[model samples]
Target: MDGFPEKILLATDGPVSMGTATRAAVDLAERGGAELHVVHVWHTVPSPHARGFIRSGLKEIGQDKLEQQVREIVETGGTVAGAHLREGQAVEAIVDQGERIGADLVIAGSRGMGRLGRLALGSVSTGLAHRSHCPVLIVPEGEKAWPPDRVLVGHGSFEDTEQAGFLGARLARTLGVEVELVGVTSESGDAQEKLHDLDRELESRADEIGKVVGTRPRVRALVGNVPETILGLYAGDEKRALLSFGSKVLGGAGRMMVGEPLDEVLNSSRGPILISPELHPASKSRVPEREQDEGPQRPAVLLATDGSEVSLRAAGYAARLADGLDAKLFALYVVDEYLTFRSGVHYGDFIKSLSENGREATGKVRALAEEAGVECEELIVLGRPDRAILTVAEEIEADPIVLGSEGTSRIEHVLIGSVSEEVLRNANRTVLVVGGHPEYARPKGESSGVG
Candidate 1:
């Protein structure tokens, strides 16, 4: 079962994004000798006459069309692809289907919806990517639709850099690609000497790992914002690229204290990002305690959502990280009591609606995992936002929980509801807080904060 995840699930909505996602999925499946399952989610408007009748009919029709598309693609020497269609919210239906089929991976495209549209409709891709209990691959718009051939890894701490080098070399060997080891240091006042020393140390470490892997890796050291510098390296004349990084420097304690740098890189980078958790000496000791005995399990991630645009954007970051770590992906949607209480709606109805929405999001994520040929799981829960999310994670024994920043500034984060902040402070596991609005268009000649 070492290389057995050859089943790929592709989630589509019969839109431009779906087309893009399908292309990417086919390429990956072909590369990995995987079977492809293409799924389409159709939305049906309910009428007064009968419940779900219209939806059922629409789903059959949509399924047929999607099946035709899959047949056409497969017939033309593409991947071995099959198609299925389901009724209901796009994200949920896809997730349920993936689970039913025991898909190895789910793939989906990031729909280029504008800010307002994304806010109202939410992002199926983002929601599904976060929640699916498998590796989810997201194909961004205007990017190449295939597994990366050349990889770049950003090294942070000494231990982390060593891990990054080892992981990079292994990945390079697996993918048969060259690995570029990059060490970034900020140009903060009077730190030039310190930065240089760090750079030399990182280079030496990378070289050692490269020798072990029988690959000659390139090493680079730069002084600038870590995020921006890393991005710049990849963007500069590197058409085929995949960004890799260590999950954290100091493990659980470091992630909690200093926050998640990988989250920021995932948000700001236009390309796919891979994250690997550092292995610690403590993990080598045998301990009876559940926490100590278990050690870290590649940093499994729980992605939380409210069916909001900001939360959906957080899914992108989570998906990239999940793929990098080969970690299990779980998508969660929490139904806050405030919304039901404020709307004066029946609690049952509210729960139903919320659950449906969560399922839809899960579908999108499932598609992403399928595309990437990674396994995933989806979940929906009810209760307080923070509590429900945390509870589900604990129940699942998830390692890291990834969340959106709620688009709040520092002052607003201090005053307004800070779910991410609270989770970061309280959760026993690691937390990744993504702070950026996907809908915010980047201006021409502006850098996408990669370094």
Candidate 2:
């Protein structure tokens, strides 16, 4: 299986925000011949004693509304496997109900665009993204009104190479639309590994998608921030593109652990973000103790080194993360010809000196990863700083790229154009633009997993 889902569940609330999800789910189910299940989780289940009393006295006004919604869906010309009503915490109920029917994809609505700085994602949609056993699809607000014309995949390293990226490509094949397996990157050094890896992976996925869709799809990766890069690609076609991504199932059981790249995109952006757990439920990310010894479960982390004060700090933190996740560490340093004052003319001696410095920087990071007992690969490449970093990360399929931040790099509004900032803006996978110290910063608005 190329990981395209077989059974899909649409979790709806009787609200305008659900418009996109409802349409997408029906379209996907109808087109793919996949079983479709629709679930409406209204509220928590009352106590047994209270239930009887409330049932007799309460009006249950929404029942009429729910039925009307169902009729419209049926009228749209698709058969529903089941349309269920349940009570309890919205996330829990949806997961539980979906599991009962063995759902492969869970679709839900995110709050629609309203006033500037106003993101009002329903609590249920947010919770489901963080906790569902299967994958999730967060429909952007106002999409119910427009059908998509293309599939925009936020492609990157880690589990997504095989999971979400491939699936998104496949979906694009199925839809017979252009597929953008886009990558956003930042770093300085050899991007060959990442680029090669991306090429091989996308080629393989295109072939697989070709089997089902009857035509091989095209794939490409551009260097930039994941969300912004994706949005830029969809700048004129926003209403016609469905943006897709992978989920973080391997870390933070009850908490949402979106990578920094996705964190930026999901917060204030308005779009459908198709998200699947990076690993299957049976995978080792957080598997049971008995499953621990069965396979290699560690994710890889990439470290971008410029030998700067901040880059060194990032290396130290990368080592810590490698040890924590038992992950492989890839240290990359780009001999930045662009950073040189005379590089515009390609001065040979200066370029040689820069290359030598790049090797030293990567060596420093390698030593750290080794000392921490983490698997490590060190490479020095000559290129633009940002592209080098992203390319290497992609080649190795690193789960996260770790870098020391000035705080404002990724989230800090002031240090907007720094290396750290560029990586976060354009990374395809999770990015860790770590600060020397820890702090909590939230985006300007409150929205669901998909803004």
- TM-scores for all candidates? 0.53, 0.57
- Measured with C-alpha atoms, the lDDT of residue 347 in candidate 2 is 32
Over 408-438, each residue of candidate 2 has an lDDT whose tens digit, in order, gives 2344323323767778888999998855433
| TM-score result, candidate 2 | 0.57
Best by TM-score: 2
**Over 4 Å off, model 2:** 1-4, 16-18, 44-59, 112-121, 143-145, 157-161, 190-215, 236-239, 251-258, 280-451
lDDT of 1 by residue, 143-227 (tens): 4634577777777632253555565565566677778887776677767796778778767877687677677578777777776
Worst 10 residues of 1 by lDDT: 249-258
